[model samples]
Target: MEWIFLLLVGLAAGTLGSLVGLGGGIIVVPALIYLGSFIPGLDNLSPQVAVGTSLIVVIFTGLSSTLAYMKHKTVDYKSGLIFFIGSGPGSIIGAFINKSMNVQSFSLYFGLFMILVSIILMVRGKIKPLKLRSKYNYMRNYTNENGLETSYGFNPFVALPISFVVGLISGLFGVGGGSLMVPAMILLFMFPPHIAVATSMFMIFLSAVTSSVAHISLGNVHWLLTLVLVPGAWFGGAFGAKINTRLKGHTVITLLRVILIIIGLRLIYQGLT
Candidate 1:
């Protein structure tokens, strides 16, 4: 029965995660929190286990999404590599922070923190039509099938800081970091939503890999369940990448905001009760 719960959570989270560029960790972490409370011996370790397991699952989802984006030439590998150069070390620092923090405090603040971040992104995301005041006008030149390319000009100044922040969050929370990275790329870098999404997945793959390794070193992983979740998440990721081509940027952002709000409220309610 418990195993059934795990499997169902994996299936539902994987499908939705792939569809939303979340890498499934957002869903998996909350579900673990909700379920672990009911298990006699599982409560104490649930969050760590959840984070570790989700990263393992994300590894598969990220790999599949990367392949799909590569097939379409949608990924900006150069920019992603540059971002990872900063993110890799940030993730390690974040892991140390997570290790020292108290879980109770983390849980109490997690949803509220994410909600605030989501609101900022939601408001900023509405500025799609506004002209960017950037020195690099070249970011407006590249074109995709949907014309979602960033101008050819790259800005490491903004990208570097954003990458470091997102990596810290990824390592701390076991999130895909897409929620932060995608929005940062769009607003700060003035990257098109499509390009932002693809690039986020690339960064997430690196973050997940590094974070997972650190978690594993601490003996936090659930190998059996990770195996079950990975294969399914891979397929789901491919499906999401394909569907993203069909969705409009505004529509995707609207939907993502709604989902985050709902999750945020749920977490707040849980914490309060």
Candidate 2:
């Protein structure tokens, strides 16, 4: 039954994570917390362990999503690489910080923050667009694996800082940072929607790997739980990618906002109680 719980959590998290360029942590953490109440032996599951395990699960989901994006030639490898410049170290920092946090307070605050983030994302789309400012003087263009072309006029100064913050949040929360990264790429960098989502998946892969190592060293990971969750996450990611290709970008965004709202509220409730 615990295994079943893990599987269901993985499936739900993976599907939405892949679709929206989020790592499964956003879903996985809350799910695990909730699961602990009913599952034998899992009732003692700590938030740190849940987060560490979620990151491990994200690795599989990230890979599945990245592969699908690769086939579509939607992922911009250059962007992913650049984003990693900031994300890599930020993840490490997040892991270290997580060690010192008071779990209950962290959950409450993080939940509220997530809700705020979701609301911002929800409304940011409807607003008159803000100017895309790059600290760098010019935009760069690249072609993907299948010769699809896209351009980014970003100021690494600006972009990298945002990514670093995203990475920090990811590392702190074990969320893989996709939820924030995709939107930043689109809203801040003016990246094409498909490209942002694809690139974010690749970035998630990189960040998850780094974060996983950090968590492992910290003794936060639950390897057995990771094993149980991975298979379902992989399946969900693959299916979500397939769905991604079929649906419009706006559809993905719409779905993301709803999920974020639901998940965010749940987190808030969990925190308060």
Candidate 3:
């Protein structure tokens, strides 16, 4: 029953995470922590251990989703690369720092962070898109695999700091940087929704790999539990990406806002109690 519960949690987290460019951690970490209370053996699991295990799960889930988006040529490698550079090192730094934090305090901070993220996401969702015709005179241009036109322009320099911060949080919480990166890309950088989601998965993969290695060295992960979640993560990731391809950019943002609100409230409750 525990295995089954974990697997389903992985699947749901994987699917939604991939779709929203949030890796499984936002959902998975909370699931592991809350679900642990009901699952016989997991009840005693530590929050750090839960976070570490979620990172491993995100590694697989992000990969699966990235590959799916890559197939559609939705990924913007150039832009993703810029942020990737900042996030990788930040992730490593965050991992080592995670070693010294008090668990309960960390949980409280993490929950507060989630609430903040949720509020920001909702506000961003409500904001009107800027008319960039005058500003972005030199339009970036491209076509997708089927030769459908797709293009957008953003300053990479402006994005670096945001990416580094995203990575720092990701490494610290085991949540994929996507939770922040996706919203930032859309709101701050003006990335098209599809492009932002695709690029986010790629970046998450890079950050998670480096962070996962750090967690392993610290002995923070639970391998057997991660194993149980792997299959579900992979399948969910693939399925989510497929769905993402079918949805409109606005629709995706709406879904993301809703999920963040739910996750943020739950985390806040957990922390408070």
Give a tens-digit lDDT track for model 3, residues 55-127: 9999999899999998988888878778888898888888887777664666677777777766665675565
Highest-scoring model, TM-score: 2
Model 3 vs. true fold: TM: 0.87
Q: Write down the lDDT of every candidate, Cα atoms only.
A: 0.71, 0.80, 0.80
lDDT of 2: 0.80
Off by over 4 Å in 2: 124-138, 142-150, 249-259
Q: Candidate 2's residue-wise lDDT over 19-127, tens digit each?
A: 8788778888877777878877888887778778888998899999899888887887887898899999998898888888665776786787668667766765564
Task: Report the lDDT of model 1 for residue 241.
Answer: 81
Q: Cα RMSDs of all predictions? A: 3.2, 2.7, 3.1
> Model 1: per-residue lDDT, tens digit, 21-91?
56667767776677777756667765677777778887777778888878877788877888898787777
Clashing residue pairs, candidate 1? 138-151, 138-152, 139-151, 140-151
Work out candidate 3's RMSD over C-alphas: 3.1
Q: TM-score of every model?
A: 0.84, 0.89, 0.87
